[model samples]
Target chain A: MEKKVLLGNEAIARGAYEAGCHVATAYPGTPSTEILETIARDYREIRSQWSPNEKVALEVAAGASVSGGRALAAMKHVGLNVAADPLFTFSYTGVNGGFVIVNADDPSAWSSQNEQDNRHLARAAKVPMIEPSNPQEAKDFTKLAFDLSEEFDRPVIVRITTRIAHSQGIVELGERQEVPVKPFVRNPQKFVMLPAHARPRHVFIEEQHKKLKEYSNRSPLNRIEWGNKKRGIITDSVAYQYVKETCPDDSVLKIGMVWPMPDDVIREFAAGVEKLYVVEELDPFIEDYVKALGIPCTGKEIIPICFELTPDIVDRALNGKIKGGAYPKYETNPVPPRPPALCAGCPHGFVFTVLKKLDLHVNGDIGCYTLAALPPYSAMHTQGCMGAGIGMHLGMEKAHGPEMARKSVAVIGDSTFVHSGITPLIDLVYNKGTGTVIIMDNRGTAMTGHQDHPGTGKTLSGEETHTLDLELLVKAIGVKRVVVTDPKNVEELERIVREEVAAPEPSVIISKRKCILIK
Target chain B: MKNVIFAGVGGQGVILASKILMEVAKNAGYDVKESEVHGMAQRGGSVDCNVRYGDRVYSPLIPREEADFIVSLEMLEVMRKLEYLAPGGRLIVNTEKVNPAPVQTGAMQYPPDLREWISKNVKNALFVDTSGMLKEVGTRKALNIVMLGILSRDLEFTREQWESAIKSLVKEKFLDMNIKAFNLGREYN
Candidate 1:
């Protein structure tokens, strides 16, 4: 095996490839997007795809698994909220071959709207969770996740944080193990989630949890290292590295499997050390679990419950030093802030510039266009998560009536519309609500490094597929008035926007242009 | 162990410079780890990466005031990450200035006395004329490689190793120009 430097996400992709995963699906969200991308770029054997959104991604992967093919779905922490519907049911339905869900958590809200810990979701959904510390572990554990998923007959969640996801480390490469796909067996009682079928499956899920807990206790992933008996630290993922670096003298209990936490193993380890501390990022999930087992542990109270943790933080916290005592504050004036901006020649910039001139309240969706909320072209007024723009635009129209609603428009990107905007656009047509939608068709998912979506004429594997026509799709959804106009034509765009918003019926102005950054 | 911080605005190739450095360090048989900022922040925002290499690296992050090297691609970004530089640490900075949104919008001004302030406050600060050097190469895109060239002077790696790292990473069309840029950086005062 040759050692190569790999990002943690790339390592996960490598792990999936080595595990003989036949299919992989994902929606481009930071810290997790690269997993599928790397697979698509590097591994030709596996079929990789960028689904419309996280929910659809999960369902696609789940469908592959039900067909007895090894599958993986990757997404960020918040994306789990979108995919939670399939995730909970998939937990009960179990798997035919194997299924692994990669959750890249952002503990400090770095490049994210929220700092959510998806470990709770793993526990809630009654699925086992694996946390990898570095790039090497990321690869090894992803392979292990598939094996555990098949053994337990359920999906596994492999969680990682921003630091681990983006960080680069050496990983030993291995050959792909071609696991033969199992024949798809039609068992309604197992696959179907009706009232009667789900009732028994719930009991089976509980039984699976018990088996997982026992497996967690003995799994090679969970191990204890001896150092100073007086002090012990319990940690996992990237935090384990910090604890190891900071408290090299202290005994460490590194938990690779975070959920269904090895109670017996934790109890045994806690009994050997005089003082135990849980060092984890974000929530004190392990600390709470340890305390519930009637064990005394120091966490969150000593370390912060907010933001990402570092070696200096861990050293200062345990050494009884006050926060900020670990290092000297350098004497320097604060630099001017450099907030992200729209590209110089971006088509969205032109659209926003026109909207700014119009002085209309533009409801925005997530993507590169979200930057329109900032700077000289502050055209967008409100932005909720993906696909919320159309719904919010409709709500604002209904609340203020058609008179004020004429002054508002829903702005969404091409990829974002494909993600979750289409359904809401239909709601506008069906309910007879008059809300103008400005679909910023930039020809790709421009925000997260230009991954292909349904609207883009390419698949994740870079194959030329059917390019969705946003104008036709809007028209097909019963939107009476649809106009496709280039945003570069400022005069024409301004005129069309004003005309559409003034019209009584539902209207869509497709701001058609390619992303300036996309080659 | 060596901890280096590379700071610059998005599209300046700070991340690529770090990657090249990490590869060089790894080729030298040292364990290396790097932390980078990606996604939304790459849209002309302040971006940075931490590259640490040694016998063993446990944490990718470099604690405040502990970095041995601060290689900044832009002047303001250097000021923002100045706290990461340890006492007696080398600050290899590009003289280029990228005006942030506030400065561009006329809400704020680029600090006029940045060079003087840095010299007075820091003992070992080297400001390389990146734009002037890249002018000879006829491209500003090679500025990062030029900066990396200057940084290579202070590192333990050889010229061959640095060149090889660049060869493996840089696209073939731009290879000769980047090599020239690297040489220009290495020869910089």
Candidate 2:
């Protein structure tokens, strides 16, 4: 076996290659973005593609899986929310080929909008979730997740946090196990999701869950480590490393299959120790499970539920060295905050400057344009999730009427427009809403490091592809007015926006420019 | 375990410098774990990475007041990371400074006399004045490697091992220039 230092994201890609994953799809988001990127860059055998959004990414992987080929899809935590619709339904339908979805959660909101614990999503959807603690497990668990997915006839969720996604560690490499595709047979009840099929499928899911829990009791993934029996800590993912480092003397149950928790092992370990503790980041998923099992455990009671945890925080909390879970104090001056900003010469900078000058209420969506909500060009007033701004603007126009529409504009990046913005633009037009939707067509996805989307005319693999025409897209969707102009041309663009918003009709403004960082 | 941090503005090659050190440490048979925050965090924001190498590295992050060394490419950036530095940790500062948005837009001022502050507060601080060195190094982008070269002085690795890492990681087209930049940094008087 060959060993090399790899980023956790890289290890996930390496695992996919080793598992002989044939198809991979993803929409770029922080922490998760590098998974698909590495797959595209390193694994020549894997056909990786960037879907418009997480939903589309999952559905694309679903299509590949049903066709009897191993498939994988990955996205950040919030992206899972977008893809949850299919994820919930797909869990019941099961899989013809091994399928895995990598959900990389951001703890402490580092490079994310929120630090959501996705194990809740995994449990809510009743999908088996495999969590790895570091780069080595990130590779090993991901490779094993595929086999588990096929054996159980279900889609597996490989849940990770920023610690496991961005952290780097040594990983031992293995050979590719190319499993032949299982032959697909046409079965209406299994493939199609109707009331008749879904009703029984729901029962099938419950039955599968029982077997999974039984497997969890026996699966080597959920192993117990022998240590001092004084303090028993049940932990998973990157928190296992923190627990091992800080509370080395404590007996531990490190659960790899976090969704179908090893109930028997958790109780056995709790019985073997004096006191039980649960060390997890974001939410008290394992803690709640241990308590439900009638095993008394201390978790968020003393541990700060907010932000990410470290060895110091865990050590202090376990020993009662800190009161009220106060963060460790450091004697240092309050340095000037270096908040995220639009890059100098960023195309969005010009548009935000113009909007600020006009004193208009800008409803902002995700991407680099979200930086407009910050200092200097505090133009964006209402910032929400992807595509929410477009609809929010439409809602304001419908509620407050023409004058409000004239005073406000909805801004979204071209890539985001492709993600979830198109439907809202159609809503504005179909419902006869009056507002200006500014598509900041910066030629690529800028915030997540310039991954190409539909509008960029380039695939994730840097192929020359068809560029989606933004102007035609809006106009074809019943928009009467669509203006394509240079965002940097402040005076001319300002005049166009003024005219479009004053007109009592839906309009689209395509602010055309390439991101400054792009070559 | 030795905890090293590369602190600077987003585009200062902090990740690259950390990666090079990680590679060298790995080659020298030490377990290393490095952590980085990119994505929107790299949009002209403060970006830093932790590089921990030892017989067995546990946490990729360096707890507060535990960093063994902090090498920064900017003045204020290094100051921001002072909390992570141990009381007796070495501080290597690049005299160059990239003004944060608030400082650039006049909302706040970049902390003044950082050199004086470092001299008084830190037990050991080495300020690398990049102005004269950039002329000899021939590029500003190589300042990261230069910072690594200065870092090489305090580390246990041989100069040849460091050069081998640079050769493996850096593209051959720019190998000669990067080697020169690294040497100029290593031999800086």
Q: Pick by DockQ: which candidate is best?
A: 1
Q: How do the residues A1-519 of candidate 1 rate in per-residue lDDT, one tens digit apiece?
A: 888889999999999999999999999998788999899889978998999899999999999999899999999998999999999999999999899999999978767878988889998999999999999999999999999999999899999999999999888999999998889999999999999999999999999999999999999899999899999899999999988777889999999999889999998899999999999998989999999999989999988989889877887898753333223333454567889988888899889988899899989989888888887788888987989999999888788888766788999999989999999998988888898999999888888999899888889988999988887898899987899999999999999988998998899998889988888
Candidate 1's error at A281, in angstroms?
Answer: 1.3
DockQ values, each candidate: 0.60, 0.57
**Cα shift from native, residue A296, model 1 (Å):** 2.4
Give the interface RMSD values of the models in order.
2.8, 4.2
Candidate 2 C-alpha lDDT tens digits along A1-519: 877889999999999999999999999999899999999999978999999999999999998898899999999999999999999999989998899999999988877778888999989999999999889999998999899898888899999889899999889899998878778888778779999999999999899999999999999889899899888888888888888877778788988999899889887888899988888887888999888888899999877789998877887888644322111232354568899888889989889888998899999998888878888888889976989999999999889987899899999999999999999999988898889999999888888888999888889898999988888888899997889999888899889988987888888889998999999
- lDDT against the true structure, per candidate, is 0.90, 0.88
Model 1, retained fraction of real contacts? 0.65
Candidate 1, after superposition: displacement of residue B75 in Å?
Answer: 0.7
The true-versus-predicted C-alpha distance at residue A134 of model 2, in Å, is 0.5
